[model samples]
Target: MRDNAFWIILQRLRTPLIVIVVTYAIAILGMVLIPGLDDKGNVYHLSFFDAFYFISYTASTIGFGETPYDFTYPQRLWVVVCIYLTAIGWFYTISAVISIISDKTLKKEMIKGRFVRQVQNFKSDFIIVLGYNRVNSEIIKRIRKANIDVVLVDHNADIINLFQLEESSMGVPVMVEDALLTSTLKDAGVNSPYCNAVISHFYKEEKNLRITILIRFLNPKVKVITRATLHDTIIAISDTDIAKVENPFEIFAKRFEIALTAPHILILENWIYKNADLADKASYLPEGRYIICGYGRLGKLIKEKLDKHGMDYIIIDENNVGTDEMIKNETFICANADDRDVLLKAGIESAVVLVAGTQNDIDNMSLFITAKKLNPDLYVISRVNTMKEISIFEKSDINWLFMIEKILINKTSLQISQPLKHSFLKRVLYKDEEWGTSLVNLLKAQLGDNPQLLHLTINEEKAFAIYHVLKANKPIGLNILLKSLANWQNYHKAIPLFLKRNGDEFLLPSNELLEIGDEILFACDAESREEIELIASNIYDLHYVQTGEEKRNWLLSKVISLL
Candidate 1:
């Protein structure tokens, strides 16, 4: 298609080019045919320079009077002919220029050419985002802030143009195409070694799945994160090798489950990691019957989790086509949730929890306000799909609003900023119940009641640093490192998370001996980062910090002992 478009443009240009060349030839020949005379009336033949100069001025309509001699009738007539010919040529060229400018295919080719150049010249590892919706927009913003390159691919030209206009030079290279096509993926350089990850944030589950599969097939090592909104969609990709599937409904459902079974744990996790205000804990979730408005995919998932826990709830949505059949035993109301009458019918005054799960942010906010006005003590969970709606709902009487876009952005940011820590938390700590609990408690005990979750790998003015032991040729005991940390500044704030030796990992034992290839991961405050770097630079430095004595001479000690 691209090649065809380029050829079409060249073919269209050929006519104007030929017309201009022919006009120049005829105009020059007419000038050369005319003769010229000197001021003395001595007849002299017009040189090629004079003919070319006269033709240039006459054709351009500049009309500088004839040089050295006045124009005869033949010369004047020839000048008229040259003017008409040049004007026609210029007009034809202008028409062709307009056609080329207005051609959509030509414009797309130019943009694609620029995009290809940017991709080929991109030096750093990048993420390829397969959509430009609310979630992917937020993801791109986060990725840009982290200085990682990103390429956006979508079939929506208007959306891509809006992004380009809004972001200007800061905009990512975007390709307008159906992202599910493997050709599109290849064009976006998904198979390149520097392409680290691909995020499928398409609205359609099938498109996201297809894009994911294509990305994985092309680059097996590149991380793929897909968004699936339906239960069946989740099941479809569950067995696939996709790295992560972000189902907002499922995530919300899981959150509700945690809130039900382990409320404190949820509170701690949210307070530390999610930037939730702990002072509002009392109003976060009040005790009452749960009323879910909008029985859409999200609403249904919430209901499923509630039913699995055997919780009391009622669903209110106008769309009851197959809803009644789906909800066999649960109460499902068929009414517009925005209506006040619908609120009263759904037991809004008595219900402790109100969930606005519809896709429309206005409808969700209206229902939330109505419910809040009736029962101020009710805990409302509002579903917000866009960034603009977030501010609006936040001003209302809502306890918590789930902006799934924000959630996905946060997750992707973590993955980009701290891959090792992110992997460790997700694969190791998060999977093991006991370990997760211990980690939560450990963080809380060290950092405080509501410390923001942070890894010390990156340098920050207010953040700490974590150093890894890459090469320690000599045997270094874990005790020596721990003792060295104690003598350093802010030792109380520094803690060793784990020590990995060989293929095994564990909490640092008091007397655990470190091997040549062992790695110790420890976290310390910002003030202690410099000192920690020094200790990590050399294995012998660990001994100096531990014993406050430098090893100076084995040769002198051996010589004296031998004597």
Candidate 2:
């Protein structure tokens, strides 16, 4: 598809076709005024000016004017021929006009040409968005909000053009071409001192990884943010030229993290959509001595959050990158997270959390096991793709594991709770399909096959608290549990909803406090907890304390009283 050249010529011909029509329009009206056609076969004499007028009039042939002359048979034949030619040409011109106005081809081709030409005019200080999607648009908007110049790229030319036109006022240039192509990449100004890192696609994690690698090869100094669909891509792109969004698997972890830490950020859009405002809180930092084992997409986001909060952390990956730049506070250990020595070297014992969010599924599992071995207490948070992997990890002693399948399931089910036509959720969730095919919504709809009802809340410990319902359990308890939250929360601040329940019945949502079956995802601020507790009725005593010796034991002990 990339090599196809057939359409290029057709695209270039649009301008010439327009010129032909404009010239023909002027000539058509005059042709009909000539004294040419006679009643018989012989020719009727007419002046050159009259001939021209007649031809022009004939060409325009609106039937608005009287005949200029009675013509012989041959002259009449000539007039008929001229009328036919004029009418056919006018229709042809109309068809061409419609094609130009309606078809995407001409516009896209022109935009691409303009983008290519605009590349040479580019100076430094530009950001590159290497895929097209709502996420990309949001990312661009964020970058632009910061007043940074960005050049957007994607396979879809029309989308890029739309961005260009919409952002024309902003003066951001967009290039409609593949980010992987060297020529196109060059047009993106990847190496110019002004060029920042390249942003990868949201869903096309694999492609993002490849593009980042290419970008790195093109210009190692340029910072690149890549994406990977699974955990292993993190490991693969660890030392490559880009940071990771951490694909679908890690995305679930990040989303769940946002839910636990900042549910307000998670809410809205009928599902969890990443908003810049909450991104900082959602990042994994704040408490010092944290370790991000894989600095891919998820890790990058986490890293940024940490930075924004002025927290300390280290990045560990097989590929050595940005090690020299990190220095004391921001350490980069070029080794596997699975290594016991590496874990210890990264202060695993003292580290608050270990994000095992590599793009590879197997790597995440292995990383979790190895991390567990090194620091049994480390909050080894990881991501998984398949539903089957959930039980294995859950039973494997991982206290803070977030599975993508369940998240996708939870989100999708929430969206399609009712039938397609009868669903308010579907209307909101699929309003524009603008978020792209959210796997969360799709998996939820598929619950009829393997029904599971899961909800989430936060607890005092700050570690995610979860409960599940198997097929054996009745669905009625969920709503009752939510209703009785006040009963459960007299002793606890965080309320846990059914974090993950495996059953066919739909779960009830409550404005109550924590309940017995509640899985609480904690928020960072007391205010967030206070807000959550307002609706929660029955809250049970689930203790949450900082690790080892508390920083301010007495201060934390009086959390509820202080509230």
Candidate 3:
């Protein structure tokens, strides 16, 4: 508790403490100066102890009879002087104490002290979040939902207080300081071993980049996830240890492309995410002229993807200034999209797909509602960046609502925490059609209608492993590995998804050969995942597998040979 603010308060009290000490000293000295008078006006010697007792009683206003003798006129005058001097000293001291209690700086420091104690005592592994903006708020919600601990830091005092009020029960320790400061990062325990991830979701791109550099230097093992809106900023941290850089517009364009091409997979994805209703699966992007409202980064990305796919589309923006020549050629009308006149001029009445990619949520909603009114069958895709006006999008029955913050957080978290699983999903479930079907079949067979993505890792709780074969290791052919795995998984339901040899990936090929330096990915519901690990690690012999013989443990065999 004795931090800088504690010292400051103590410094302020120095004056009052000095006042009290000096006042008592002077009063005692005065009492001893004038000697006490005895009977018949004779002078009596006054000891220091007797003078102390007299001054103590006088200062406290509990005056009693003199112990040694009665007081004379001069001594009585000194006693009166001591009483007022001590009273003035105490009054000043009490005021100072009250002033310190009500001081804003002192209260803030006290809060910080409590936060520091709580963080130091926190037992669970936590993620350090750098900002407390709208995006970070959604991220915080999801992090808490996963029952993960969070340490929050922000520069705004009011926002911190608001968060403390809202999430007080979660016991989230918050630090109100500039996140770019290394001292602030250290105070948040970013360098601690338990701090697995640092997510820099600051509003400014520069702060995120600086935090990325700082975290990589401070603790290279701790993964960093950041968001960048500028192209140059994204490119700057691409080769660094910053594992994830979330760009909302880029992600939106990719998802948009999926909606246009493989709408079924997009529907399945939304169902898995639980972001939209699955019953509207048939109402994917309809085939007709598309209307794109806004000419900003988000709008441009969607249009570029559409142009690459040879789709017809029209763009409507408020101004033609600073517009790219190619984009200007596709601009249907250089007018306000919210105006009904511009909507009519852009053929919104017959448009099948309408995308509201504007920065303003209200404007996006207005354009969306206008398009729906013009063409009720219009496939509406709207962007919502903030939580303030989400009800408008919800009540309008829009086909797709792209919450930018939610998407960014999901993308970043996937890359940081479950990179392999995300890689598998992004590569197979979203891209390769045959592999996507194979995965869907796997999930359907295992989970039926409640298909959800799961990872199989070789932690204590789960029996799973990912390993790369080395040249020095024995080369166990794929046929032998599969036969042994199949026999072992009879009780454990384990299956290998793919094998990466060199840079080529082979998915579930029964005849594929295993070689040195091949990486494998596996998934299993039971403890059979360990069987594959043993098979890949050269624990089982092909002869023992071909016949019904017990296989020697490779670890024990190596130990025996060493002996």
lDDT per prediction? 0.69, 0.53, 0.71
Q: For residues 1-563, could you state the per-residue lDDT of candidate 3 as single tens digits? A: 34767787888899999998899889888887787777877877677788788778867778787667777888878877888899898889999999999998888787777777777786778889887877677677767766778899999989887887775327788989888998888888887878878888776788888888888788888878888878899987666755578788888888787766665566445644555433433334677788888878788788788888888889888764325665567555677889988888888888888888788998998888778788888888888977678777788788788887778767766554455545554665456334444555664565343333334332322321212322335444555444544453333344566566666766654545555445555555334444545544443433445445766778899999999
TM-score of each: 0.73, 0.36, 0.74
Q: Whose TM-score is greatest here?
A: 3
Off by over 4 Å in 2: 1-49, 62-77, 96-104, 114-124, 132-139, 156-177, 187-194, 201-563
359: Cα error in model 2, Å: 8.5
What ranges in model 3 sit over 4 Å off?
31-77, 122-124, 180-183, 191-193, 213-222, 237-240, 271-284, 320-332, 339-345, 412-430, 452-457, 460-563
Please give, for residues 1-563, the per-residue lDDT of candidate 1 as tens digits. 64555777788899899999899888887777776556877766666688788877877778788875887677778878888889999888999989998999888877877887788887889888887877777677767876888888889899887888655228488999888788888889887879888888767788777776666678878878887877677766655676688877766777776666555445444553446633324222455599988877788778788878777888888875435554575487777888888788778888989898888888888787778888888888889987876778777768778887777776666677555344443434223344445555665566544433223221222111112332323444544443445453224444566555556766533556555444455654454444555554544555466557664567888999999
The top-ranked prediction according to lDDT is: 3
Cα lDDT tens digits for candidate 2, 200-268? 654556776777678778888876665455667677777673553434444554554453344333332
